[model samples]
Target: MDLRQLSPTLAVSPQILPDEVPALAAAGFKVLVNNRPDEEIGAEIDHEVMAQAAASAGMGYHYLPFHPGQVTPQLITDFIAATTGRGPVIAYCRSGHRCTVLWALSQAGKRPEPEILEVAAGAGYDLTPVRPLIASLASRRG
Candidate 1:
């Protein structure tokens, strides 16, 4: 797991296996967020498998299967609630792109646009494509 820290509370990774739970626990991530949809990858790393592993390792697990262009407010809300003021979190997707987007969107009001874009870019994700959505989410804060 090549996890990259986007913030002190949130990290992003390309993928994670059930066996990697121990390392995640050692890494101090209290929560595991699986953002990859089931169909995109094989069943080997599905939600149930990860959830079981996370639970056994004493970590919280949340599966919010986010497909491109299908992100929702509820998903963001759930993710925020799961990670906010909690221990470190590691969120994963196929290439960490979707997970990164989810993290950025989740921080719509809490973080400004420049900081959000910078953090995404620093972690090798391009938020330019989601500029409109970011603006919309940020505007909703007012």
Candidate 2:
């Protein structure tokens, strides 16, 4: 998969399959966060399959389906808690958009505006549309 590093702790990629787990493990990603809803994709890439694969590979897994306008504080909290101490986390969705949004929100206060923007851009995710929200999140941390 084409995985892009958003930070030392986080990476983003398109939807990943069971076969890709070895490569992910080899790449040093200790956690796999699935942001795609199961129904959106076919059965092949459902949460259960990915979760089994991740578990088999001895990696931590979290299924946090991020539907547009459905991402809540609880989801973010769960995502953060699941990713905590899980170094080199990799989050994936259809086009990596959901994963990008989750990562941005997760970094709300821990990272600066410019740094967050730069990191998102570097990962090929343009956060211009959500700049205001990002700014608000960053300010909240201050």
Candidate 3:
């Protein structure tokens, strides 16, 4: 599991199998978010399967799928709602790129761009492409 810590309570990864759920729970992740839609890779990792695994591990599971260049404000809002105060969350996508991008965009004014980019870079994700969007949304923060 190529886990990358995005925050003290948040982590992102590429893809995960159902068998990894128990270890994830043991690692202290209380929530699992599927940013990848089922259509992306067919029925490879069904939501129900992940949900069942998460439940068996005593964790919460949320499926919020989005494609590249499709990370909307509403999605970010949903993510914020699903993850707030939920403890460590493990969000995954194809290569963890979409997950990381949406995470940084979700930060907006909540965190400085430099901080967001720095954290993402540490996780091996480049946020330069969405730098403009991050700046735009960040400005909307009050």
Candidate 4:
């Protein structure tokens, strides 16, 4: 798992195996957010399996699956609700890019644009392509 910390409370990663859940829990992550859809993964490592692993490892699990371009406003809203005050969370998708994008978008009104971009860049993600969207969301919050 190439876990990339985007902030103190949030980290994103590529797909993680069920066996890896305990390590994540041990890492102090109280929640595991799955951004990968069920259809995209094998049953051996689907959300059900991951969720069970998370439960056994003593971490909360949330399924908020969606493709990269399929993100809706409701998805972002749910992402915020699922993670806020839930303690440190590790959200995973195929390459972690989608998770990073979601995290960036969720911060629109709460954080400065430059800081959001900078944080993503530090985590090896380029949010430049989504800057306009971020800006748009931020403007709406004003």
Error of 1 at 75 (Å): 1.1
Q: Best candidate, TM-score-wise? A: 4
Which residue segments of model 1 deviate by more than 4 Å? none
Residue 100 in candidate 4 has what lDDT? 92
Q: TM-score per candidate, in order? A: 0.95, 0.93, 0.95, 0.96
Quote the positional error of residue 67 for candidate 1 in Å. Answer: 1.2
Can you tell me which runs of candidate 4 are displaced by over 4 Å? none
RMSD of each: 1.1, 1.3, 1.1, 0.9
By lDDT, the best candidate is 4
Worst 10 residues of 1 by lDDT: 77-86
lDDT of 1 by residue, 45-73 (tens): 88888899999999999998998889888
- Which 10-residue window of candidate 4 scores lowest in summed lDDT? 66-75
| Candidate 1: clashing pairs of residues | none
Which of the two candidates, 1 or 2, achieves a greater TM-score against the reference?
Answer: 1
The better-scoring model by lDDT among 1 and 2 is 1
What's the ranking of the predictions by TM-score, best on top? 4, 3, 1, 2
Q: What is the C-alpha lDDT of each candidate?
A: 0.88, 0.86, 0.89, 0.93
